[model samples]
Target: MVDFGEILTTVGDFGFFQKLIILALAFQNVLFPIFFCSFLFIQSDPERHCNTDWILQADSNLTTDEQLNLTLPREEDGTFSRCQMFVPVEWDIGAIREYGLNETTGCRDGWVYYDTLYDATIVTDFDLVCDRSNLAEVVKTIFMAGLLAGSFIFGPTAESYGRRRTTQLPVVLLLIFITVAGVSPNVYVYMVSQFIVGAALGGYRINSTVLEWIGVTKRSLASCMSQMFSSVGQCVMAGLVYAIRDWRRVQYVLAGWQAFIFLWTPESARWLLGQGRTEEANKLIRRVAAINKKKIPENLLDVTGEQEVQTHSGNLVAHLSKYMSFICVLVILRFSLNLGYFCLILNVGKLGLNIFLVQFLFGITEAPAHFLCVWVLELIGRKKSLISSLLAGSFFCLLTLAFPQGEFHVIRAVVITALVTTGKLFLNWGGSVCMVYIQELFPTSVRQTAVGFGSIAYRGAGLLSPLLNILAVYHWSIPIIVYSSLTLTSGALSFLLPETRRKELPDSTHESNTCNNCI
Candidate 1:
């Protein structure tokens, strides 16, 4: 039987053709960070005070500071209350100033946000503060639900159809939905738009799986490259948000970028061959050969290998039952990584520092971490790398508990910020390593199915992460404790999985079963 890898070598592995595909796919990955991290700024609970400006009718000569002092109650910390204000009374300015009214009520007029960083965010625009603050987490949860739905839809669509069609369609949908989200008239409309945006983002995982066709030697490189591009996007988003301040404009910029990019992307020839489309696969191979200046025999793909593999690919349930242990561990690890990584990211505003600077640090640190992850993956192999990164990430997550919980101190805030950043970096590294590891561990016949199941777990954790972050209001240590526990458990269980470094990708259930025994 003529394997696709053999055909790839005959043409050229990691040649110009492969590099171009990687670049296109990696560019799409940038959207992951943009969408995921946008919440940090978009839902930011910025400094706010009650809208007590009705007093200005009587106190025309009062300064801004004087109006606030007269119309709002102060907390023990000496800051004006955000949700409460002194009841308005029709009295002269001098009389009210001397009498000092004490009755208070909810900010009936509304809030007056003092957000110097952003001119408008979902929180500010929608008034999702005080009693309405819980809505912010609900919006994130809806987006994650969309991600989960997309995983279920796109994963099988890629397997039944082709990877390129499934991937390309989402890019177009994402652009349209992002534009809708940008100009949303109200919170309800924005939530729906965000859901569609998340569904579109799910296509990126399918796009990434397309790169698995490259030879094993460059598979890690491809994975790391995609991750680095995502990190770069995070940095770009930080700069854009810093400059624009308006979340709507930021969404517009992201949508505009999508319109021009990804016009012409190539299909995965390996996937075409897997679907028994010999002529299409042959033509793509010849094109790659021509671009790489290599020649291939006419009978290069003359084999029934792919058809035989397809017979075993039909029943996802059968694969799940057959490889229960391997699939479950991958799913658990995905859940753990997603939960830990996003928990830290969503809490960026909680860190008592400049949110933009902290977010930029979060973005900038990822490139080096991914570089280090690739080196670690090459040095110790996939299984060990997963274990080490997860455990290290857990350690950092645990260290966040050391920060004082009562009040925000600059020194404590700085230390906790560093701890969370380091923790997030390690989890991000684990996620990058896990991306390649999933492609390598499963047989080609059931690989996408396995990834789909794992993605369900990943998005499930994403759905929970924001809700879990809300628990911080009760006790600051609650979310960190939960994150650390899950990460530690995943790291410990990673010992049971097999290593697949430098090994040929399995094409059948029998081969995958053999690989499963190698641990």
Candidate 2:
């Protein structure tokens, strides 16, 4: 009979070839976040402002429906319908100018050619202020809600099928959904497509598994590198958004890039070996050896032996029993962090600053933060790093709340901007640590389910962020205060988690040294 336990143990201890495969898998992690951040551009309401001038110049004698049909582009089906676009005459140029249109060069002069009934008067009377409560905002929220659902779904599936399959599958699906989302005939299609894309992209979790597969000496460096890719993704997303302002074109570009990832990426050898597919695993390992120009050990084939075959088993209930308590704390922290993060990013215009500048600065700041996290996580340990970040982020979130209502525009801008951006560093770092920790906690049998359940908490919070933003308008400081409190509490809960630095991962309940009641 095959000694399944022995094979699993050998495979669990990764070699140079396996490590390289894990690193390659990490690239998918980078791409997933880039696709995720691009969502901000897709959900943008700026297009509404672009058409403001045209809507105001429509014939005054025309009915509202007639005016809408005259101003908006014909639908893909060749129909003039209000349902085709989310923004209507309510966002016309006259309204935008009234609220304070900054630059007024695009829709001037010859662009306005109309008869007497549809006079081409320069509309300076309409309000420039965008309504926060609108279809655009609602669609954005729904898209994020899909991200929440996707995260949970992907985490478990990745664990069950193997990291490479779970990690790369989403990239393919994201490409398709993003393309569909971009070319969507109307806002309704756009909203649905964005949600599906969010779900597809949310399946990536290779960073955590990659960290676990490498040597302890390499863990911090590897973790840092993984985070750096996310920052790179952010910068890339910004550049892509700028290059392709048309939302659909942006989708097509991202989709095209994602499709390329499958060409170079490989499966996780550890996962394959765990399933007792040594020959297949060896083939993959040899491919890595070939690429890196290293010789594969002939003994590696014998290493699989006659052990390590075991049926993986886990469900939602089993997942909860393992880490429900810890997961709960993370959920609360994620919800608050996401609420604050999205609230600030989504409403950057409300802060009276250049939106593009704010986003660019935010992306630029992440480079240093990623490096800092690498340094801090190794020195203080994962629990301390997580707690300290949460506390710092909470403090800054609180400061933003205390600043006077209408004083020191520049100072408030600098202070609030610093607080939120710095807070993002902590959130991102802590989140990375959480991903690593969750994967380490469970055995391969239930790892996917555990990861999936934990992801639910993270995504669930994301779903609620848009609604929270709406509330922030009426009570600006409420979200800040709430998020700050949640961070502090999650930090305190960190004390309950066992520190797992430099420990060999446990293979079964017998070898497991889990902290009792730690969850």
Candidate 3:
């Protein structure tokens, strides 16, 4: 009898072809953030313009040349006339003038009109006063909540239905929500769409499955490549935001791009093989081999399952009994890292930096950080590397708190940005290490459930970070302190974890039991 499981496992392992797919799958992650973050540019309040009613008034009488002379160099000449423009005449100019608006070159000469959109009685501030007040934060919160929900859903679904179906399911759903979100008529509709997008994103099971398919030797490289792709997504997102200034339009573009991904992407052969569908698995493998211009191994094509047993058969209680502790640690660490990283990224304007430029710089810095992680993982090993990075991040968070506001804003910005970026690098590395660690720690009977439980921490953190930011308004250092403490604690706890450097992945209960220290 052929040992089909062994052959499938060996053939499905990572190779040059698998690397290509991992790279391709990365495009969606990259695009998702780009589309999502683009909204920041439109909704930004760097100059606190959210409540301002500055209508560019064109002078109908003035010729084009005259209009050009009055306007600043940056304003588009076609839209406004040379004439003075003001908000509704009823607005209180007394307060505006008190702020030195009347003394300014633009305000005094009637070249620019500035009016406060806030009415103490009517309530005009959309983010703070209206139904959608703090809509951006709400969107982020809900999106992450959906991810938590999706993470649970994807694990079993992928294990049961195969990785291909589970992976493709989210991509389709992402496309749908992205389209709807782009043209959302109101904040409610937009938030709802974003929630769905987050849910769909949660369903994706490709990263782990893809890594599983590769050889152990290539796993770290493949995982690193995955993080690199996420950075690429950030960079791509930056460019897209620059092109599509409108928040809704950017969402539409992202949705459309996700839809395009279905064209060439393939399902995981390892998943099919695991499900006792060798023929189907071989078919998918052949397709990959074709793309890479390599011949499919004859023995791989003849693979068969060793046994037929129902894999994912249990409830929350059963999963908890097996892997709750592991899940808790992962969730706690992921949440802390995400809280600090995202709060830093999403609240760029609050830091008093050029929002776009800062985001651009953040994305650019990831490249070096990623490369450094690859190098560090090799030189220092995963435990020390992750701990050091988290410690450094905590230190920088303290530095950010210690700096006096306003005097050295630029220097503060650079240090915080660099530290945060570096921290993210370590976080990514730690996450990958944890993923492998958890798989080895759990029994195959409950592996997916265990991983899902761990992922909840990640999604849960995403949901909470935005709320933390909102609270940071009152005490900015609170969130940082919380994040710093959590990271330092997680780093220390990691020391207790047995190092799995260069060990073969554990499969059976006996193997897992023997490697308890590593777990």
The candidate with the higher TM-score, 2 or 3, is 3
Q: Estimate each model's TM-score.
A: 0.89, 0.74, 0.76
Error of 2 at 105 (Å): 28
Could you arrange the candidates by lDDT from highest to lowest?
Answer: 1, 2, 3
List of clashing residue pairs for candidate 1: none
Query: Which candidate, 1 or 2, has the higher TM-score?
Result: 1
Model 2, position 327, has a per-residue lDDT of 60
Per-residue alpha-carbon lDDT of candidate 1 for residues 1-519, written as tens digits (9 for 90 to 100): 777778888889889888888887788777677775446685456688988888889967789999998999999999888889999898988888899889999889878887457788888888888898878888889998888888888876776776778878888898899999989988999999899888778755655655555877778888888889888877887778878878888888889989878645777675665666767877888898998889988777666446544644467567657777787888899999989887887777778888788888888999888878777787889989999899999999898787667576888888888888888988989888778877888766567777777778888888889889888889878888998999999998898888878777766677677777654
TM-score of 3: 0.76
> By TM-score, who's the top model here?
1
lDDT of 2 by residue, 121-228 (tens): 111112111332266566667777777778767776765577666766666677778788656665667678878877775566432345434555446656666667
Alpha carbon lDDT of each predicted model: 0.80, 0.58, 0.58
Predicted candidate 3 versus true structure: per-residue lDDT over 1-519, tens digit per residue: 343234434444555667667667655566645645633554322221221123123224555444343332222654433222333233343443343222112222322212432111001212322223456566667777888888878876655665567777787787787888766656677668877777787666333334545555555566566566677676776676666545566666776677677333565554454456657766776665565566655764542433322332345365455555556666676667666666666675555565566667667767567666666666666667767766776666666677545664677767766665566555555665565556545554455666676667777777787877777667767877777788778877776666555555543344456545344
Question: 117, model 3: CA deviation in Å?
Answer: 17
Collision count of model 3: 15
Give the Cα RMSD of candidate 3: 8.1
The CA root-mean-square deviation of candidate 2, after full C-alpha superposition on the true structure, stands at 9.3
